[model samples]
Target: MSSRYQQGLGQDASSLSGPVRQRSKQACLPCRRRKRKCDGNLPCNICKGYGYDCEFDNGAQSANLKRPVPSDGSPQPGGKVTRLTYPQEHPKQPTESPFFPGILEPSKARYVGRYSSIAFPLYVGLEVQATKIPRLHSFAYHTGIRKEPPCAVTCEAAQKIPWNTARSLIEVYTATVHPVFGFLDMDQLYVRCEKHWHGQPQDLVFEAMMSGVIAMASLFSGTLDQDTEMWFILHAKEILEDCVISRFPSLEQIAAWTLRTIYMRCTARPHVTWLSSCTVMHLVEAAGLHHASEFVMQTTGNAAPSPEMFNIVNRVARVATSLHILIAFEYGRSIITLNGQILENLHPTTGAKDLTFQLCSLVAAVPTNLSGDALPMMQELFSSLDMITSVTVDHDFLLLLRADLALGIYRRLRVMDSKFQQGHNDRVIAAGTAALPAARRLASQNRPWWNVIGTVFQFACALLVMDTPTSCERLVETMDTLEMIVDHLNTHLAKEALSTARQLVRASLDKKRRGVESLEHIVRDASPDSTVSDTNDHLPQDTAAMSPSLTSQLPLDLDSLWAMEFQLPL
Candidate 1:
């Protein structure tokens, strides 16, 4: 056998030179080490399933050429090269996973919608085959601030408010909303308001800014009814509409738009808030606020912007970035793309803002295509958030951060094509559980932010989809929080989705109980005393008949839940 094999291997290279054969694509290093077949995709199917970083040996083909010849007098190189060689692994440098090639294609234009994370449940609905989801327009609650006609108007038009009323509103704003964002310098704003109220000349920008502040203050303070609040908001938008927002936007313009976006957020107008947030980004970049130092240096006057101005600029930039990122990352869309590093470099930062920006940067790092390779990054971000000990950061913010991160991770995990769906359920449930307290706190407030209501509902839906014991427990807590938010806010769309999610959870729990009972019955019937031949007869003959309890309790089947339609108004 050895002689015959040797004779067969000794055949001349010319004898094998029929048509030049093409070589197959190279396997990734891990696959080659284990001697497993590889399809050679960016993340090969096997590596992707196992959650291993798929790496290729770029030098392998070249190294094959320099291999030493065999001693058997054949032209072929030495025995096949098997081991993969790599340099010392660096901890700081993560393996660069290939981005989804489709996004990188140069010829195509990318399209991103103006939707926030609050709308993420709709995608979950799609996954569960839920159908006839109402269009976003149907449930939209616009603040009915009529747009003024094209006729030109002076800043004086916005100054028709009673001085006492405006003063009280501004004070309310300075005390409540201003601390969270610090979008305006209260001292500067107060001085300006004093001047404007006394019939002194005021810029359109100042008028617009004052109007926006009053609008939000009225809404936040709850001193006025909804209609009264919308009246103030209308004046603000009218003044803002008059400002000539050129390439170089003024501080007041930035403040005006920022306040508008915040008001829209408080009102729970997701689409409007998204659009306003994008406008803020455009104005921010146009004014060069992202690089505060350079912006100060470029000031045309002998004296640059004051420290107070700089502080406001920095805070507004950070707050605007946060607002836009929260929505963009959740909905997986973007109109303006800001670099994480630019945000990471903001000056005079607070702990909460810094941590929040870091979170934003991490979120921005998530691949647009939702590749499984980003799991390591996602895990690291979540763990880092868990380790946060800064007292300056609001507890509610931290809770929402964890919940949002978990939801993001869950979405990323679902697309991984892994066989074990339960593998990451614990991690997601833990996150959802951690966020429940924050939801309750938000609900207990006079009025929760729109995001609070949306987040609680979405998390409940996510946990309902999970349908595990721990998840269901958390789901109940989440639903309770959602109910609180819905009752307090009285948002019809949330109320509708909340009802559907509750039914789904009930059905899921019932299905689990029935499953447990059926298993117990099988175990009892198959006792040692029972005849083996009779086991089949004793078992339920019709599989369809077994779920009668579930059918009677669950008015709609799983498919019916997906096909359920809603006519809820916006």
Candidate 2:
């Protein structure tokens, strides 16, 4: 080789001046900025590697770049480069639909963005698709919370209350809660349970009866700490769990669950209440209480049960059935998959001037999920609303509440039915935007707790999922308003709800402002042996991080079941 160079009259190796630098035209623009090795292929390896809209320039000229890429072509010890090549720069063709830049294959991109198309099902982003709930750190349990059945607790606290102490609590309950629940009989409770109250503290029915009274009294008192409510519920639940584990089925067990459901409702745990309500229904059916009339006839036919005992079980069954129907409606679940027979036998126990009876009538009149003629359903709901023209101090506390709930449910049905309609969307936004403040106002004016807060919150969530600027703005406003009133809520359940609402709002805002880079959208690819750098952690200081917790928190895996239950704050 030396002899050939000498023969060709080339300059000596010493005179080459250290390989002579290119007087400075170097890597392409993207490679220069990313400090990556450029293959100099018009869309350089680095640009192509990151799905970036790559362009190029020398000292004299540059051209248009469109990208679909992996990482740069720079050599790592075991670097796995996905090399996507494209035509050399076409000066006339402009790129379209540029999304946020990312690393890896499109599916595994670190900072993935929404897929855009003129006519196809859009993937909002592979990242966003990963966290279906958009983890806003809200108190609302993600669908994956393993809800174990109720556990056995001694409820040493509940059993210790003296028999004499229950009278006032019972009075408070009869005065405040019974009017709404209507699932218990005061005369029978006072007459038949007095002996158990003074003597048998371990009696399940006695514990349930006192728990209801104490819990209701605590709630209606209006100033008790939220834990006090849970304490009452925990105590009551322990009592019932004892009966349930024993597989005991009785009219007393039915009454206990009715109280438990009421407590759950009062505490904003409607899903829990639904669970309790189903138990009540199960017991009702088991005891043949649902066939109250037949049971009465048969028992009378045998002369084995007194008419009074027969009437008690019959009324308890009737009220429990009514309550079940209402919960089913509120939860969008069909009760017993209601049919001609069940609907025929269905009636609200006819002994109370309370909200349950009113709701029972409405439930019997309007089918769950309202799939029939909209005109008739709307008219019936309106008729129910008309029955309560004004809410006065004398009015039952739950009257205006469940009425508002019916209206909210009606609106929800509208949102579901006309989802694609612009009018429906607009009305929903308007109603949800206006509704939360009204709820807060009502809570302030009357009671701190509203049975329908969950409905309103769910509606607000619906608005947010719409993903429009209007929806987002309304959600922010709703969260801000809820924030102001959250502290006033006396129960931890409702307080936790407002706190979670704020978290979700914050998460939504981060998602909106940061595009699709939030960590909730992070997807782990199939590469078991590959290690990817934290994409956002390496982000330049100029751009804000989408999720600060990206490095620490992993997006949780969940089922879609929790999403449905999220309709309530449970």
Candidate 3:
């Protein structure tokens, strides 16, 4: 064997006198089981390359001389890190280990800016028309370090904000935001709050959870401005820093992170919310909340979570999954992989709750490319969503669900395929038309939902694609709704997106209206009653010039609109 190959295989090539050097017995358990070469690192080269958790056998544990020390330079409690449980020396590095086939290097990780429409593109781009499919970029390892910034207010100070005031904020959050997210067990949160106020021992996670709740409540209640609300948010984050670094995050920690994500959304930080949502999903998996059945089965020790705990877990998991999925769909990338069985376990029996879960599941299944063969499945999903509209009134996010489906259809519709072009066009129009009214109603309510701008803008884009007189009028109406939403927004990316959409729609409307007028003038001059002769033109020269060309451009096609490359951030 060549020297390099022998060295890589952990075999000695220089010493022919000694027995052929065998692979290190100190290889991680995963490497050993898979019969792969290992460099015997804490996380062996092979295990790291395959993105597997590296564990060592008891006999091999002592052979690892390089110990991962805590920040304080003290040995870990056990005097040895085992199975990769010790906190990583460089926490800022990718959370997931590198996979050999699809390496996700830290340098490749990019911040999808607040203004970038790359995530929720007006169309799915050229992927639908290409013969070869593009490789999917996984954000699994693109994790940001979970460090907390210095907070202006401490947890104790936040707790002392007058019980009456605190109670009011919590109640407002429960009534407004809680119905939508439904992650928190209100009773449990109340109990924790009461205990903390009554001189009971403090729990950092619960405190963090309450702080997040207060911050969101403050935003929705209009009791505090963005700056004031941020104090509570910072307080929650400071507490969560400890929770995030813990070996195992608790349900409370997950709830706190979920709330933080929700707050970020309300403040119109889509990119930040995406990153935060990802962090929450990771915490969900860390808590083993994703695999419901398996989590309960795998519980150790005499203490198992109560039935209430199970319900809370399911609720949090459902919301976290839905939120992550929603953002992932927009970005065209995701880290979590949930299935129907897990969703079924998380779904509530009926009402708006059940409907929300159903919508999430349907959206998760939407294919990136809309081919003729995929129509049946898309139709079924669309049908399911339509049925949902009939049974339930739109709530905190129902409008968004509808808009997203319409946008998905618009993005992936294959206009060139004559075989399915008509079918494709029909689907986009119907979905857009259906979502328009819902978007109007949601915006008319004057509630500043985090997703309202994106949802309303999406419906408008879909209508613009139809390029019909009626669609234009509806698009105008949608723009009016967007105007109201933007007025309420606090100068965020969402506001800018809606403004951009409105401008494009207005320009398109003007061009279409001009085309109709030009056509009308030409028809008027050509009427039978007209005294003008065919050879001599009584009409103005410019009017005559417009007649021939105006007919071709009468119905504004998406060709020019597409050429502009107008993209709005979600």
Give the candidates in order of lDDT, highest first. Answer: 3, 1, 2
lDDT (10s digit) by residue, model 1, range 1-570: 111212322333232322222333576687677665555555554454334577878765444334332111111011211111011112122233332111000011111121323233432442344444322221344666875345354665334666787788889877666655655668767777887888785766667677788878877677767776777678667766653323226556777887888788767566777888888887666554443121111101112223333345456676677667666566656646543334544443555344534444444433333335556656644443333312223546456655675676566445654333454566567666666777677666653455566667678878776666777667667877777777766767867867877787788779889999999998878867665565245545465754454434343356764665544559
CA error at residue 504 for candidate 2, angstroms:
9.1
Q: Could you tell me which 10 consecutive residues in candidate 2 have the lowest summed lDDT? A: 294-303
Q: What TM-score number comes out for model 3?
A: 0.57
Model 2 lDDT, full chain set: 0.49
Model with the higher lDDT, candidate 1 or 2: 1
Residue-wise C-alpha lDDT for candidate 3, range 1-570, written one tens digit per residue? 011111222322233112332345466787666555555656654454334688887767777635432221111111111111112122332233121222111111111211224322211321133333222233343475765444333447344476777778889888877766776768657766766677774556677788888888887777767676777888777777652334336666777888888788767456777899889877766554443221121101111233344456566777777777667666656546643434554445454455545554554454433335666755644554444333433454665565565465455433322233444555555555555565556555555566667777776776776676666667766777777676755466757887689688788879989999999998877868575455325434554545444435544445753564433459
Alpha-carbon local distance difference test for all models:
0.54, 0.49, 0.55
How does model 2 score by TM-score? Answer: 0.46
**TM-scores of all candidate predictions against the true structure:** 0.57, 0.46, 0.57
lDDT of 2 at 30: 56
Among these predictions, the greatest lDDT belongs to: 3
